[model samples]
Target: MTASPPAHDPEPPARRRGRPPRTESAGTRDRILAAAREEFSARGYEKTSVRGIAKAAGVDSALVHHYFGTKEQVFEAAIEVAFAPALNAPEAVAEGSPDAVGERLTRFVLGIWENPTTRTPLLAIVRSAVNNDTAAAVFRRLVAAQLLRRIAAQLELPDAELRAELAAAQLVGCAMLRYVIKVEPLASADLEQIIARVAPVVQGHLTAP
Candidate 1:
């Protein structure tokens, strides 16, 4: 049998050299986002460029575009990553009875802002948004698309869209004054106090007839 036709061993699978494949696009996206955040914080949105971000990320400028499209898209992506942990607020709020949703929402949002880790990146975004229309637009789109839309869908009130938008405006305004602008009493006020004071107002906007 021709020496039993020496057993043919299957070729060893190709070994992937270097780092293992990145399974999480979010991780790669987040690296680009962190670099963008630093760049925007340091250079301001107007001065920040894709090429700069690409250089910071150790990737080609084209790769940045491939991942995020335009600069506006990159800014939006950065905002999403920065605020992603909070994106579930609407669903969380909607889970409980309507009457208590606002309190839950308030607590959630305030907790995010009060946490030092989340707060730093958030503050950076807020500062950039205030100084640059591009950043502001990106912020607006993110809120409208992610937060407000989800809230509106869960709300059965008349003009739910308007209500969601109004609630977002109120919350964002409070954040601006308290965190970004650092207005005196609001800035120094304890988190519980702010949540207790603001939750009812937000609740009225969301659930009142």
Candidate 2:
């Protein structure tokens, strides 16, 4: 009798359960940012938590911390993505006709608020900044350094840095009224009308003798 093939050893018992090693997936960072945007948008910055972001992202809380380090970092990342086109203002100012630079800058910056896609998160970030000193610092740094300073650097003027910041202040203030605060007449004002009124001020700041 062909002895039955030696019985295979019983399958090794399954390894006991334990936490799995953390793996950073390629899209994980992007996923986290998207989730963060939603959380901050829905709850505001102070109310948003890393655990909430992780829950929305379908990842462990530790994974969110691993990728972003802290909630403030996550907020900064979200704002950067939302403001990317505006943050690119330096290039627009750099390439445009000198006379039209202010108009182009005004349009580009306001156009972001005009677009619903970019506006919502911006509202969240601005609202958070208003309430939280830490958030305000992050917002101020990015706008000053990435957007304003770069424009200032390209100018041929005394105190170009201050000039650029003043122009930015006008645009940012307009955004606050027109978009965030939803001031009645300004909120409903015609885009061209608003642009017409604001661009001159910006031009003066940038090109005044």
Candidate with the greatest lDDT versus the true structure: 2
Query: Residue by residue across 1-209, what tens digits does model 2's lDDT show?
Result: 11111233221111112332224343666787889988988888899998899789876666666657789988998989977878778888889689988998999889888998888888878888888898899888988888888899899789999999889889999999888778999999999999999999998999888
Each prediction's Cα lDDT score? 0.75, 0.81
Q: Work out the TM-score per prediction.
A: 0.77, 0.84
What tens-digit string does per-residue lDDT give for candidate 1 at 89-203? 8878889788998898888888888887787677767777878888888877777788888888898778998987787677888888988789999999988898888999888
- lDDT of model number 2: 0.81
Ten-residue segment with the worst summed lDDT in candidate 2? Answer: 9-18
Residue ranges of candidate 1 with Cα displaced over 4 Å: 1-20, 23-29, 58-66, 131-133
Q: What alpha-carbon RMSD in Å does predicted model 2 have with respect to the real structure?
A: 10.1
Off by over 4 Å in 2: 1-24
Lowest summed-lDDT stretch of 10 residues in model 1? 1-10
